[model samples]
Target: MTRDTPHLWTEQKLDARYENLFGRAAGYLPENRAALDAWLDDFSRDVHERRARNAIVRHPSVADLARLIERDRIVRMYVSRMINEAHQRDCKNTVNDIPDLLDHLDCIVTSTPKYQGPTAFPMSALFTYLMMTTDGYAVFRDQGFNKALLGILREWCAHLDSKDSQEVLNQKNGWLSPAALADKKLNLQDFQINLQDPYGGFPSFNAFFHRELRKDKDVRPIDDPDDPRIIVSANDGKVVRIRRDIKRSDEFWAKGQRYSLYDMLDGSDLTDLFVGGDVFQSFLSGGDYHRWHAPVSGVVRSARVVEALMFTELEHTSGRDAGTESQVYGASVNTRGLVFIECPPPIGMVCVMPLGMTEISSVTLTVQPGDQVTKGQEMGYFSYGGSSMCLLFQKGAIEKFFPKDNTGDMEEGDPIKVNARIAQAVGDEA
Candidate 1:
């Protein structure tokens, strides 16, 4: 799709789509409602409730939201309203209330995401309905609240990493199902799967989510691997934006969601090297390949995962595609993995950043400092969540971008294949 074309369905369409999906589970059962009521009562009367209450009030944004809304409601209240709205819309199998929401979230943590088009962002969808509002948006921006949220998500990630999460690998309504493979356009032949083993020998949902790509030259061959000048895409995704003369710090929260180098790199010591450099950002859909690859042959200099907020999105752009448009903003604020590679001269240093969006916050890195990496070599992968990637180049490092495009222009939603030539180094003529 072109940049001008909206990537999300309208509210009516979104509602209809989710409604149909939920219909299969039957509307929230009576037992679920009873459990929800009981939990709510216990949650309200618990002596430890103040701890949960403080998780909101201590955060600046949540405090601001409470004042503006003229009430100091707890997190449970906010989540309950959010889930109730979805329940009221007749979206089946949804949480009956806040307690039910926790249980639903637990289920998601242990199971892999089902194949559903763009509407696969169920958590984001529920948050979108609530967070698009003035109060909800402010509350989500609170660091304390997000910290608590991240703790919960980390636990979920642990569960996803365990063997129990592999139960969803069945051919029926699972990731390997015919319907899912067709929907994702994933060919098992392109990957390294154990044909003899059930569930393709994957140990967990996370394993299946970041399945290894075959090393055959033709499968995802490096584009001119010997040519250091030919920079390739680090991951399989759609180009979101390409910006030059990036600032050290900018109005990242503004409408454009401009790149803030210092913030994006997590204040790394090497941030200054790319002050006026260029950044190539892209968005990875739930169904897209999740592995990271070297954009240029180089030696890994530094690599680390930076912890940050999990669910915050640009308030103005919430609800549509569940903050897919907020990628640039996410790069600055979300949890991400950063890998700095020092390539041959002229190409200099390149930084590959994988930013986690919403529920997809696990950034697993396979390489470490001092390791030599070749172009298209696997560096890491993101486990089961919406994700985006950014490649940062040093000032004047790149002579041109979108190597095949004569105009050297890229829109927000342009598809970019992994290992495909994306840019050219400044000194390389070929």
Candidate 2:
């Protein structure tokens, strides 16, 4: 079927929501010659330079994409620095006094009283990056951080392969049907999504949305960060997987492309990520970070971290210590073990936790480093999403173990679910 008129997602449709977020963050911009005592003048001037620098364009290649992402890292750095500047501009201390500053900072991004939006297209990218960078591997691994551009890039990926084919070149890089959202009435089932594969037939919506929803766009989270049910843990005792990889230079960002960020670090050097001693208590949010959880209870025998897509977010737009702020997951305590399965839980662990979560719950590792657990047994949970778990086993494996267990609160350890309300997305209908 021919898409007569694809609803155009014009530049005007982007969100210019003012984040009334104010606080001091770390600095990541190239410093100017201005003296430290005269910080305001230095910060304002430097931000202009920073934005111009980030706006620099380069050829879109694997090597170049990696450099772009690494350069994009500065966005978080500058935002933190500038936000801190804003806090210092005013005489505010204590977490309780932050509300006014948040409002002040919101003005910087949106139609605030102090200023209007800058020339940056899609300002949300900056916010999205901040959120992504905040989460350590523990969270980022499972949440599709590396595969950030999947939704928007499906179409673009095809174009990259079909460059010489005139017919392919003539085809549209589909983003939306021109009138896809007329009157705000959308029948998701009626939405004809297709991944233009090299094949000659069209794919079903079930097959299309997952494969070709969007192509080659930067990672844009759904209306809510937790809407994807992609957290890395489950209610029943099972293992979960998280993965990370960057293409800045073709070498994997951290561990082999499939390695989890948490399993490789310790509390001493990475102490900032752990909350007291609770792994679940530790979370990463801010700067466009996102998460996904496992949909069913099963053992994660093997996993792979692929360098899926690359798109850059502009960080040099605003000043920090004023209207800009960013933070990574404050705590990542894996010694407590990010997720625990039953005795010998590493292989063939049966689980019964429901596949859905309405909130994030505190997860208690019922088993020790190598203890065993049964299906529906208390493993861990969150009052919301952005959290998930997985399990793993070797190849040629075949076994279905039933539970000698029942669902209940942890007793020997008394597992608990501490609900958290971390982020909110405006106008996210889902």
Q: Which has the greatest lDDT?
A: 1
Candidate 2 — what's its lDDT?
0.24
What lDDT does the true structure give each of the candidates?
0.66, 0.24
lDDT for position 258 in model 1: 78
Instruction: Please give the distance, in angstroms, between residue 101's alpha carbon in candidate 2 and its true position after superposition.
Output: 4.1
Which structure among the candidates has the greatest TM-score?
A: 1
Candidate 2 residue spans exceeding 4 A from truth: 1-77, 80-257, 260-361, 366-372, 394-430
Q: What lDDT is obtained when candidate 1 is compared to the true structure?
A: 0.66
Report the C-alpha lDDT of model 2 over 82-178, residue by residue, as the tens digit: 3343333331121112232222222222210010112111212222213212221122232232332232222222322232212221113221233
What TM-score would each prediction reach against the true structure? 0.75, 0.24
lDDT of 2 at 240: 22
RMSD values for the candidates in order, in angstroms, are 9.3, 22.6
